[model samples]
Target: MDLNLRKAILSNISENDHKQLEATIVDAIQDGEEKMLPGLGVLFELIWEQSDDQDKQEMIKSLEQGVQQANTGS
Candidate 1:
């Protein structure tokens, strides 16, 4: 069976309110389970698609900073 993971993930969370969506992300990150990564990636994909260029640039900057911080443990 072929699984459309992005569609499946979006379908599951489509009804979530803003707070619920935030909680879902927080909980998933806190849980730190490998299974949650795909859902997060799908969510980020949705955000990236919806973001304007400025928003995307800001997100990229934030992510770059975060990755650097994580790598340097600072």
Candidate 2:
């Protein structure tokens, strides 16, 4: 995940939950090294479940903008 996505997620979650989620994500990332696609799917599901609709939309928009910037830069 990009910094923007991580920032958005952290912004929305409570401090306590954020720490727990961070640990969970770190563990998942380590596990994901052996199974990348599945690990990514799990990460997405975890983020999506914790996020509200507005945050989801914001993340999508941020990603879209990033793609556009990259395309234009190229």
Candidate 3:
């Protein structure tokens, strides 16, 4: 079978409103199953693609800080 995971994931929630999207994200995150990662990645990819340079930089900085905090058990 030919399967495009990203395509499937995007299509699944393409019509979501902002609150629906937020609920999806929060639910997936709270569930914390490995399978949810790819869906989150796809959503993040959409965000990154739409973001400007400054926004991208801010995301990178936040991610960096998050990683550092995780590593330190903070």
Among the numbered candidates, top lDDT falls to: 3
- Of candidate 1, the 10-residue stretch with the lowest lDDT total is 5-14
Please write out the lDDT profile of model 1 over residues 1-74, one tens digit for every residue: 99999899999999999999999999999999999999999989989999999999999999999999999999
* Candidate 2, position 72, lDDT: 100
By lDDT rank, best first, the candidates go 3, 1, 2
Model 1 lDDT on a 0 to 1 scale? 0.97
| C-alpha RMSD for every candidate | 0.7, 10.7, 0.6
Kindly report which residue stretches of model 2 are placed more than 4 angstroms away from their true locations once superposed.
1-37
lDDT of each: 0.97, 0.69, 0.97
Q: Which 10 consecutive residues of model 2 have the lowest summed lDDT?
A: 5-14
Clashing pairs in 2: none
| 1 versus 3: better TM-score goes to | 3
How good is model 1 by TM-score? 0.95
Q: Clash number for model 3? A: 0
Q: In candidate 3, how many Å is residue 52 off?
A: 0.1
Higher-ranked by lDDT: 2 or 3 = 3
Q: Alpha-carbon error at 55 in model 2, in Å? A: 0.5
lDDT for each residue of candidate 3 in 1-74, tens digit (9 for 90 to 100): 99999999999998999999999899999999999999999999999999999999999999999999999999
What is the Å distance of residue 39 in model 3 from its true position? 0.2
